[model samples]
Target: MAQSIAIVSPAVTIDNTLGALFVGFTVACCVYGILLSQIYTYLTHYPMDRSIYKLIVLLILTLETVDQALIGQIYYHYGISNFSNPLTLIEGAQTWSFILQQTLGSVVGAIVKIAFALRVWRFSQRNFWITGLIMILTLGGLSLALVFTIKSFMLPDVFSVVKLRVLGTISLGVGVLTDIITASSLCYFLNKLRTGYRQSDSLVSTLIKYAINTGALTSVVSITTVILYNIMPNNLIFIGVFFILSKLYAISFMATLNTRRVVRGKGTDRQNTTANHTNIFHLGTRVPSMGPSDMAGWETAYTATSATQQEFDQQRPIIPLNTTGFQDPTLGKRPAM
Candidate 1:
């Protein structure tokens, strides 16, 4: 009797494993382009946004830039610098830039989630419970993610990362939960603000939809990363997905800020009509629409508009917004806040 066994070198599987990382890098580059456009739009359209808001946008952009450079170098080391040394690619996901890129990604995620948590706090009229919960989950996810990233560095190779699978899964699980809760709470508070007026209700509905969409993209990707990590722990499929995570978070953050333009425009057009009494808020001074430009201004605008509606329902005299006027350079007239 004779028996034959075929042996395959792990390096040969680079086509599937390293290939995943390459493809992921390619996709991340495309998302990066989109992020640039969004940032440009934000700067142009919302120039009046608070300094802190602009600073955050620029900071995240800078972080993402470094992250991209790190990813590029990691790939160069795998695909170009060590082309003949296939075993190097197969042996590990470790590179000088690899851990840094990974940890930076987690940092980006934390920043974006915390920003949203702050938004929730404002949108819910400073609901401590909901805002606190979101912040806790965000921090928890970030901490676990950092731990997993650090653990990867100590590992001998990609396959050895299997021991840390539970840590990875838990980190991603917390991220998903945070995303869901953040989105749901936003929708709930927004829906609660809906007045019986068709125009007001429609605007609230639009915001709710936006909330769902912003939360959904990141949650879906996080879920996919989790699934792939568990199912293909030995491969770079999950790493590829992980590469795109920061980009999506940045995009979501930008989209949330930029959408205020569309909503504000609609609210403007709907004003100056017979529905004025019902939907239009008559304020003593002009306040820019609710936007991240200035949390204080946004809070003032929100308080004016939301409080006006309640007062109207109670048949009380309509008190004008007491905040100081800030002209919208884009809109010739003071637009509805």
Candidate 2:
């Protein structure tokens, strides 16, 4: 009777690692909810943004949902149910979920990279070459991932991902480069757009810092995955790292989109007006809430509402942000070289 009910102990290490992975996944899902909350805050905080930006939010939500679903399925079958039948683990490893996660994760990462590249283009007033380089890298990384998907499943009854090392290496390499270029381009353009006025310079600096922080996150995770894969090709550690990389990418981008108020709060160095009216920041013109353009005599009491509505609107159009967090299309652009 005892022999009939025996459990395998050899699978314990892998099982524990998978348990850790699921814990990470739960935390990741919570972080994703935080991203959704930011989106909700953005909607309530401002007037309607452009339709395209809203569409992008919806697309990200859908992709992340599907991404989580794919992995969740594998976790349920191979990780949870197979605990009682360790032999089933070998047979259950790496199926369509394995293939689709890589593909979908790459797709999500590419969308974010391309979105940041477009931001650089906007800041540069359409710097064709710089933006073009970023876009090319984005496409290159994405194409390699697609090739990996094809090659991975193309073999005769074999789905050994380790066999596609070259493709995987290049794909991750290009992705890191893409993120670095995107972050650097935005900071460079923002630096050049500095108005020589102290108040505006403070705002631009805040933007540069935010760009660097968000940009570092996804790139660092990708680099870690690459290093792990090279050092442990036979192990599942790399798979665990790759599993959460997509969530990091999505969270970073979504936070950036909805961070106007957070960024604006940093710009207010002196005493602030009430929160409800304090967050408005017009990229090119003087903040209506902050004070008059003449910061030389800047005073908190000079609230925007105290001015005539038509006059305030004409100065900067009270236009809410369009998704990419572009403060003002005309306000912040590099002077032509």
Candidate 3:
């Protein structure tokens, strides 16, 4: 009797499922990115500076497209004998894309958190101590992400075998910590703005909801990737899971950024309307109580009188007052007497 062992090829139908998911996610991100770009253009045409933030988000979406394309290629080429050989250019491309996807996700997450923190600082007038603390935390989180990215890629000989597992664990932990810090800061600002009630509440609620959703998605992806990597150990199923999770994460991030642009745009419009009203009042066209030049003259005269009184007191006896009290030539006082 002869016994035969079954050899498992590192490919499966799951690759196709992942490919379909990636394509769907890519299309969604592209559409959302286009909308964001159009919104950015509209806001910039109104001359709002916040358009710059939207532009940064557009760049992130572009990166997501690249990441998805690479993953799609990997999935499409799966199990092809010519490309399945380990260390071949195709395999290298797949590995590099996965690494890049992870790195870009981490960077974009940190950037979005930083943007929120900055917006809070700008709008809420939070104390320097609070702002400083948030800044330190944001920077610390970013630095940790960068360190993991460098370590994961730089020591491939030592890391490639278990790097995904290690990096995934680290990424999950850091992502959680960053999310918590950001959420707490957001809550603090929201609480501070409680008196503003409706507008502030709505803005904060939207921000928190999206931030939490994105954070939760990222955590799930990171944790799932880690578990799959450990369990399958270089199996194609793990790769499929990784790609699917990455696409989901990218789509979620793009959505949040797009929502933020809309919120910021509305805020700018309100500000412009308020500024216009203020301009009308200042120009004396709205209130009509005082012309601009009259107000200016009155202020100047008041200021001159106060200064003269102060100077006379300072130089007590040095200045003399005439008994005639600087005669008004138009009304001669001596003739009347």
Best by TM-score: 1
Residue-wise C-alpha lDDT for candidate 1, range 127-168, written one tens digit per residue:
899999999999998899888887888987656777998998
For model 1, state the Cα shift of residue 28 in Å. Answer: 0.4
Compared to the true structure, candidate 1 yields what TM-score?
Answer: 0.78
Instruction: Quote the lDDT for 327 in model 1.
Output: 59
lDDT of 3: 0.48
Model 2 scores a C-alpha lDDT of 0.68
Q: Which stretches of candidate 3 lie over 4 Å from their true place?
A: 1-51, 76-95, 127-160, 196-211, 226-337
TM-score sort, best first: 1, 2, 3
Q: By lDDT, who's the top model here?
A: 1
Summarize candidate 3's per-residue lDDT along 1-337 as a digit string, tens digits: 0011012223323333344334545554565465456545434432332445447656666765676666545444432432334233222433455456556656655666566566446434555766677667667756766676666666443125455466456655665565565556655554544334455446556555655665576567656656766775544444444444444544554454345335443222222232211111110011111233433322222111224434655687654556567655786456654
The stretch of ten residues in a row with the least summed lDDT in candidate 2 is: 297-306
Query: Model 2: per-residue lDDT, tens digit, 1-337?
Result: 1122224333234534455457656766676677678667656653344456667777887887898888777667665776675445433445677688789999988887887787787667688999999999999999999998888775432125667877899999999998898889888977876665666577788888878987898889889989977876654567777877887887777776666545655554333343222333322122332343434322232221223432544596444556676556777688899
Candidate number that wins on lDDT, 1 or 3 = 1
Question: Runs in model 1 with CA error above 4 Å?
Answer: 1-12, 268-337
> What TM-score, over all chains together, does every model reach?
0.78, 0.73, 0.53
With a 3 Å backbone cut-off (N, CA, C), the pairs that clash in candidate 1 are: 49-293, 50-293, 50-294
